[model samples]
Target: MLAEPARKFQSLAMAEPRSQQRLPKRLSRLLVVGFAVLIGLMSVLVLNSVLNLRAQEARVAGTVELRNRKIELATDLLMATYSRHNSLVYQTIVGDPFEQDDHFQQFIKWGYEVGKARNALRAMRLDGFETARLADQDALLARIVELHDRISDLARQGRAEQARQLIAVDLRPDNLKFIDSVDQLEHYERDRIQAELDAARSASRRAIFVAVGLGSAIVLLACAIAYLTYRQMGRYADTIDEQMRALEQHSAQLKHEATHDPLTGLANRSLFYHRLTEALTRAGQDQLKATVLYVDLDDFKPVNDRYGHAVGDSLLQVVAGRLLGSVRTTDTVARLGGDEFAVILLGVGEASRISRFEEAIRANLVRPFEIDGAELVPSCSCGHAVYPDDGVGMDTLLHAADERMYAAKRARKGGAAG
Candidate 1:
């Protein structure tokens, strides 16, 4: 049973990599398919919109064509009535037999053209008002045609005066009424065409609005998908970058701890030598001299014995602060070992400058330290060696500074004995 369970666990562990790899591939395919569907949908909408626009164009065109044809028919009917009226009046006035006959023939041809125009108008679609106008015009034309034929007969019989009297009394007035009826029909058709065009335009605008709305929705959906995909792919890289930054900070902290002292948080023996070496190298390059101060606390062992290690450690930390304050930032101060500190002051070209700096260090140490309800005076013995004057190398400078420290201690001991 244990063996079977172990094998199943191993199989699950092995399956994870394959699943992880397939996940991205599946997501990619899904994204491609989604875009394809969106594109196809957009194309369909565009195709539908295009078809709608073409249909609207055709509708408007047909409406205008009908209006024009109807107006042409009305114009033809009016012109034909005018021609017949003038022909009847002319036949009654003219004395030449041939000329009167010619005018009569022209009148008949114009009347035939008028009938054809009416027939065409009736075959077409018309508003209720237009159909009523046509009926009124037809009644008027029938009366006018009867009066005209009587006038033509009177002219042919050479009773021209009677024909002219009939034309003045009846035909002229009826012709004007016929013209009015045709005008009404033309006006009605114009209004109808404008309404049809307006409807077509409204439909076109609605189709366009719908297409724009759908296109914006598709664009927003695509953007959302793209954002999700980008975030999904970048998550691991972001995590790795964060962890790398943390590791780099940890490595930096470890390196600092290795090179510095824990008690004072100052440079230790190893870093001090490194700094001293760099300072000397710079001094050698520029032909400038550097200074080294080896600091040792006086009676520190007695203080530790009297005050306990805790108080002694606090005092050491306080002394470290004072030493750091005494030097410029360009200078280096280090805790070499217990109660022992060293300083390297670069570009201190003249040995005379050391006295002023030494006075500053002594002033800070001279002040009493208040710790654990006790006022204590802490003093240190500082012995310094100058570059190229004592020796150019670090080891030579260190040895010379150390010897001078003991010599100074001995001189103080002798003076106190006196």
Candidate 2:
């Protein structure tokens, strides 16, 4: 009786469905494949949108160039017409026949330029309205040319007075009308170009919106797939959690490395500028004052030359620590590379406050540092500039501070030489 019961239990256990046991693995694989497909689709959508935007930008650029060229040609035509009229007037007034001939030749040259500009303007692409405007301008230009030719003929025939009268009466009004027409045409072309640019921008924005929507959808789908996979793989949660923690730590380390000096671990130049900008902005809004102190290690180079780079680097690290200890928590201390460092002091109201802060930094740095069992004394030259007083900008403040720092350095050198 006992043997039969045990055999039945074994047979039941062996008969359980193996496919049901493998279902989670197959589901996980499916979710992974789906996620990959969604990502690929998203990439394709983004690329297509970018390509379309570039095409639209190219079109806008070409339209702008063409519009500018059209305006230039129109202006050239107007000026040439005016120059021709002036030359004709000059030809009539000049007493010397040779000089009169020379003025006539100049008039002919200007007429050729007008014809060339008109032809070029006609060759450009034009809308129906622009075409009509251009036609009207051409008619006006033709009338001006006719009047100019008549004036030239009268001047050549020694009818100077009659030529001047015709110019003052007939030529001036027609020339002004022609110039007005050219101005109108230029304005029309500029309006068209602006419309084209606006349309292109609108299209680009639409494409971006579509791309963003698609990308969001893809991300949501991927998240759903990931959630399902996570549900099926609950047994590996601890491992995933550990990896996430490690990744977060690595990301933090990378950020710190990017904004900090690797050796001294102080804020680097980029972070310094970022902080300085924020300080300046706050100072402006709060009606408070700030100061920037540019610091240079006076004898750091000799120390590096006498000792090796390792000792030099150690000395720099010590200097960074001293600088940090010298400033307020709200203040920023940064290593502007090499033996140079910067400090931004906030809410510095009076000149004496800056003097006190400078004195404290100097006092901290003047202490001797023990390196390689040898006593080494480091001295620094510091220059300071007040916000709004020196100038109301980061570059200006830094420049002012740098100038002061160099002046201090020069004074020290001079005193030592003396």
Candidate 3:
């Protein structure tokens, strides 16, 4: 009956003490949560960086590139103006009447180039300052063009001196004024480009600083979460180990309590039956003789009545100790309850050895018990039933031994009465 629990307890005891390889459930959850938090934080940072880069790419591709293209067109206008001025100067120096048509043709071609450049600039979207500056430059170019037209007329009519003189008197000063105006527009556009570049760089630096700060914070936060989780797991593992150890000790105590007598600390009735059954089986298989001794204390109720149950319990303990001392370690001694005790002896086929066994038990149990300042001498009636000579089965052998013990008790009472 007690075998199953004892086996379970034995298995539990044999297991390594408080060894836990698996993490606790709560700690596992905490680690999972920490991992998720890290993932979430990193994802946000990456997504934000991606978005910012995309925005910067859009600005660079759109407004900034367009503005730079506009600056290139302004530079083309400046180059065309300078080329027209050089063509007018060359026509002034080459003053042959026949070459006049050729120089005028060349002069008209350079003028067309300047007009084409101005038209292209006007076609694009222009700010107020760019429009006003372009208009002012156009007015100055018109004055220069009017003077060239007059010089062209003089040259074609064979008035070469008047054509050459018209250059210094009007054309040169007007072209110089136009050059200054174009330079002012170029400087303004260049300043705007530089300002735009500076703004972009400052924004980029701010974004980099913010991204770095947030990334560092997230990394530190993840590390802190990880460290806390590790510490918690350690504490949780220790707690689980402590509980496992406590349960192991409790199971061992329960196993002992289940099969042994509380007061005498000997095998109780359950264990007694179990041992007797095993002994009978072994002795029968070996074809060897075994002995069962059923012992009942004489006048044990009087001792309990005289000295109280405490002394009775003490006497029983002393009797159990003596019986254990008298027998070989291989033998079984048990308390069947109250003042009754039993012993099982296997492989004891000799008649002399069985007699010596009984004598030793009787001799030891007859000694005085001293407990709580009360000293008492006790006697017991013992009966033996040898296996096969008595019975083969466990219950049958036990019943035979019990009946013999009662018969001995009756004989002792008769002798006392006489």
On lDDT, the candidate that comes out on top is 2
Q: Write the per-residue lDDT of candidate 1 for residues 333-402, one digit (tens) a residue.
A: 9998888899998888465788878778889987997889767798877789999899875556776787
For candidate 1, the per-residue lDDT at 381 reads 79
- In the order shown, what is each candidate's alpha-carbon RMSD? 53.9, 23.7, 60.7
Q: Which ten residues in a row have the lowest lDDT in candidate 3?
A: 231-240
Clashing pairs in 1: none
Question: Tens digit of lDDT per residue, candidate 3, span 325-368?
Answer: 98999999998777999998888757788789878888998887
For candidate 2, give the lDDT.
0.77
lDDT of candidate 2 over 184-265, digit per residue (tens): 8867866776677557656655664565455445568754543443333332333334433553465467457656889998
lDDT comparison, 1 vs 3, better candidate: 1
Cα lDDT computed for each candidate against the true fold: 0.76, 0.77, 0.72
Task: Output the TM-score of candidate 3.
Answer: 0.48
Mark the 10 consecutive residues where model 1 has the least summed lDDT: 228-237
RMSD of 3: 60.7
RMSD of 2: 23.7
Model 2 segments beyond 4 Å from truth?
Answer: 1-20, 220-418
